[model samples]
Target: MRVDGLQDLATITRQLREQRERAEAEEKARREAAARLEAERQLFSRAVGQVHPLTDRNLAELPTTPPEPLPLQHWLDEERVLMESISDDFDVSSLLDTDDQLSFRRPGIGVEITRRLRSGHWSIQRQLDLHGLRVDEAREALGEFIRHAHKLGVRCVRVVHGKGLGSPGKSPVLKGRVQSWLVQKKEVLAFVQARPIDGGAGALLVLLQPARSA
Candidate 1:
C-alpha cells in the first residue's frame, strides 16, 4: 500500500512539473510575439512601403503596382521633335496608288511609337469606330481620352474610326467626329489624316500635349 501511494505521489509530481513547464513555454512564446510586433511597428514607421497592418484597408492601399515609367522623349533628349521640321503637306497619292492600299508602314515612326508604348513612356491609343456614340457622347469620351493621353505623356496616338464604307451609310461619321474632336482639344499639338499605308481615311494621327508631372 505504501509503495502504491509513493508511486502515485511521484506521478502527481511529474504531472505538476509538466504543467509548470507548459506555462513557461506559453509565456516565452508570448514574449517572442511581442518582440516581433515591436520590430514590425518600427519597420512600418521607417519604411515607405511597410504600412501598419492593423486595418485591412492598409493592405489594399499598399501599392502592389509598379511605378510610372519614364517618357520616350527622355531617351533622345539630345534631339528635339519640331513639328515645323516635319511637313504638313501630305499627299494621299504619295502613300497610296490604288483605292485598296496601305503604305504608311513607316518603320522609323512605327519603331519609335512601339518603343515608347513598350517602355510605358507613352500611351498609344487604338480606338474602334464611334458606330453607336452620339455627337455629345463621342465628344465627351474623346475629351476624357485626350485628357488622359496628355497626362500619360502620349505624344502620338492613332484614333481608329473604321472606314464607314463597310457600314450602311456612305458618309464617314466617326472620321468627321474624330477630326472635329481633335480641332477642339488644345492639348492636340498637331494631327494629320493618317497616311494610306497606315489606316488612311479610317484613322488620324493625334499629337497630345504633355501634362506637368507631380
Candidate 2:
C-alpha cells in the first residue's frame, strides 16, 4: 500500500514538472514578442524627433485651372466628312502622261500652276529625302508625307529622290516612280521638276490642295 502511494506521488510530480516546463516555454515566447514590439516602438520614437530634409524646396506654383480639353468630337466629324468626299474611283488616266523631263498635274490644273511650282513661287513648307531607301520604303514614305502635308494645309513640299547617280545603271529610278505616286494621291494638285538650286531633276516640288473644313 505504501509503495503504490509513493508511485502515485512520483507520477503527480512528473506531471507538475511538465506543466511548469510548458508554462516556461509560453512565457519565453511572450517575452520575445514584447522585446520586438519595444524595439519597433523605440525606432518609431527616434524617427518622430528627427526632421526630414525637404527634397523639393523650390517647388513650382500649381496651376489654378485645369487644361481645356481638345475638340475631339468636332475633329472626328471633320475627318469622316473628308473621308466621304474622297472617291475610291478617282480618274488617274489624266495623271499617266510622262513628259520628256517627267512631271505631272491633275486634270483641270492650269499650266500656270506648274510653272509657278517650277519657278519656286510657292514656299516649300516641308521636305523628304529618299536617298538610300528602297522602292517599297520610298513609296510608303511618300504616301505618308503627302497625306500629312495635306492635312496640315501645307501648300508646297519638296521631295528629293536622289538622281540616278547612286542607282544601278546610273539612271534615276525613283524620279519617275515618285511622279506616278504623286499623281495617284488626290491631295497632290500638281508637281513639277525642281529647279537647279532645289535638287534639279533629282527632286520634285509638289503643290497640295488645302484640307477642307469640317
lDDT of 2 at 136: 77
Per-residue lDDT of 45-138 in model 1, one digit per residue for the tens? 6777655556544445567788899787775643432221222233333432122322222212443442343334544454434556765666
Candidate 2 lDDT tens digits, 93-126: 4564456655677778887888788888999999
List the candidates' TM-scores in order: 0.39, 0.55
Q: Give candidate 1's root-mean-square deviation (CA, Å).
A: 18.4
Give candidate 1's TM-score.
0.39
State the displacement of the C-alpha of residue 147, model 1, in Å, after optimal TM-score superposition: 0.8
- lDDT (CA) per prediction: 0.59, 0.83
As a TM-score, model 2 comes out at 0.55
Give the 10-residue window scoring lowest on summed lDDT in candidate 2.
84-93
Q: Estimate the lDDT of model 1.
A: 0.59
